[model samples]
Target: MSDIKVISTENAPAAIGPYVQGKIVNGLLFASGQIPLVPATGAMVEGGIAEQARQALSNVKALVEAAGSDLSKVIKTTCFLKDINDFAAFNAVYAEFFNAPAPARSCVGGIDLPKGALCEIEVIAAV
Candidate 1:
């Protein structure tokens, strides 16, 4: 495991479970799922899917940066939504983070997310 490293940051929510925020292995960062919880207070954010998506992606960005990567270095992402109808709104918010030639993504709706959040996101980035 000499090539493995754990990634953590105060800018992102602390993990309350057995998992860490992210892990780097052989030049790749694999971040854990991030909900809309505000890292400073550990409280879920307000508003609809858009707000939640932004917060969640913010958490993801923090972890990615902590691992010596950026959103632009992301290779893939997986998003979960509580309602499929919110996909459009979430996509709009997602675009604000990932630019042209955005990282490949796999977003699924109608899934239960942590903290009663409307959305959650996890990422795989180059570190």
Candidate 2:
């Protein structure tokens, strides 16, 4: 088995559970799902779905970067929304974070997210 390195950073919200923020193994980084909690305050960002989506994506970016990778290096992502109806708004916000040839993505709705966040995002990237 390859050596695994745990990834964490103060620039991103601390993990609220037992899991670390992410892990790197064999040149790949796998980030945990990031909710809309503000890293500095540990408080859920307040606003609508778009605002919440932005914060969640921001948190994902921070964690990815902490693992020595950037958003452009992300290969895949999984997003969850409390309400599927907010998909369009969430997509618009998400588009701001990634460029052309964006990472393969899967967004699902009607799901319960941690800390009552409107959205959550996790990423896989090349380290």
Measured by TM-score, the strongest candidate is 2
Taken over the whole model, the C-alpha lDDT of each candidate is: 0.92, 0.92
State the weakest 10-residue window (summed lDDT) of model 2.
111-120
Clashes of 2: 0
lDDT of 2: 0.92
lDDT of 2 by residue, 1-127 (tens): 9999999999889999989999999999999999999999999998999989888898999898888889999999999999999989999999999999999999889988887888989889999
Writing each residue's lDDT as its tens digit, candidate 1 over 8-34 gives: 999999997999999998899999999
- Give the Cα error of residue 106 in candidate 2, in Å: 0.9
Q: Runs in model 2 with CA error above 4 Å?
A: none
The superposed Cα distance between candidate 1 and the true structure at residue 58, in angstroms, equals 0.8
Clashes of each: 0, 0
